[model samples]
Target: MGIPLSPRPARVIDLETMRQRQQARKRLIRLAPELDGLEMVYHLPSESDAYYGMPLLAWGLREDGEVVGLVPWMERLTPCQSLEDPEHGHFIGYRDPETEELFEDPPDHKVTELEQAAAYFEYEATEEPTLIQQLPETQGTHALCMDDSGEPWQLKQVFGWRLYSDGAVEALLADERLIDSTPILPGDACLYPGHSRHRVVYFFQRQIANRIRREDPATLEALALMVMPADQEG
Candidate 1:
């Protein structure tokens, strides 16, 4: 048998919700280990040096499995982190990880339960994703995409490799789609699916938002707020 499954019931809680979410994420990290070294293909539209749309595929996959993604999503904060105490930044500068900048009187940021759940599903900025995914098996399929006529395209060479989690990734896709359209983790490097990191991140974040809205509406609002661009969130 694989890793023992965690119920992760959606009963809803109060303060302990954070602790519960963290526990769920930690447990997932230890469960599945097969996703390591996997690759997903991203197909972004190219219009003379400008990329448009987000079409994701898988690597080495000849297209036979079931497609599960194609949901435009965005999440502002991955690698969920808590805010430093008021004293910590008393007279110091802060660096915006996304922008990679330092600011005096930096805006405040904290890891909410919603963000934690996102990390649970897909870690941000870090290498490993699916640290808390319930499903361990990945298949290949057409899956839903922004602009797909469902026609087989000619797949070229591997242009990108594991570019989603770290930051911006660009890839050249040459059809056949992934093997069974397997489910790739967020961090899995492939082609840059969206035009910009900001847009892609938001799309994924929205994915998490939909999950919350279904399982727990209470989290949906805060999650929507947090997933906004850093400037907007601030």
Candidate 2:
């Protein structure tokens, strides 16, 4: 008697999977107008109210009428009262999808500015070539640091790459490695460069990192992975 071999798994076609994705995309396309209308109803502040203290993330309208952004410190699920509205005035809230009725003050609404802005662009159907712009990179004002540990750190001061008269490019980064939950780089007893060749690699804002963690925590895991374990080093 011969032992029976397990049957091979059937080969699968990816067409159905691809079709589902296409259907999802089409659904977003259908909702494009509704998303665009939300912009008119909810107002994002044009400038920071607190000069020294600004939200980690904010959306601003460009001169040509495009909304550009920064990562928000936290996803604001509650509908923020429009900037034009008085602080004590009635705040507009979310609408019931099934009932098509607006709620005056909804508890636990799950919408954020990042989601709303991203969806607006995703829904738009465009055939024209995309116009792109670059935001200026400033060391302390506009950057964050990430070390080998995969935690997001805020920049203190960037002693970035130097292009010297001899044409050699040398760079050094100080790690503020997510200790004590403070995002800013520390003043003393911190990890400096040359300890690990690529220890401090990513320059991202903590708000953006938090958004990624919220949306897909796996992203942080990926960023944290090393090619080889530190213990394996000779």
Model 2: how far residue 191 lies from native, Å: 11
- The C-alpha TM-scores of every prediction are 0.21, 0.21
lDDT of 2 by residue, 4-34 (tens): 9999999988999988666444221110112
Compared with the true structure, model 2 gives a TM-score of 0.21
Candidate 2 segments exceeding 4 Å error: 1-159, 172-216, 226-234
Error of 1 at 115 (Å): 32
Clashes of 1: 34
Global lDDT for candidate 2? 0.32
Worst 10 contiguous positions by lDDT, candidate 2 = 28-37
Q: After aligning candidate 2 to the native by TM-score, how far in Å is the CA of 59 from where it should be?
A: 27
Evaluate model 1: give its lDDT: 0.29
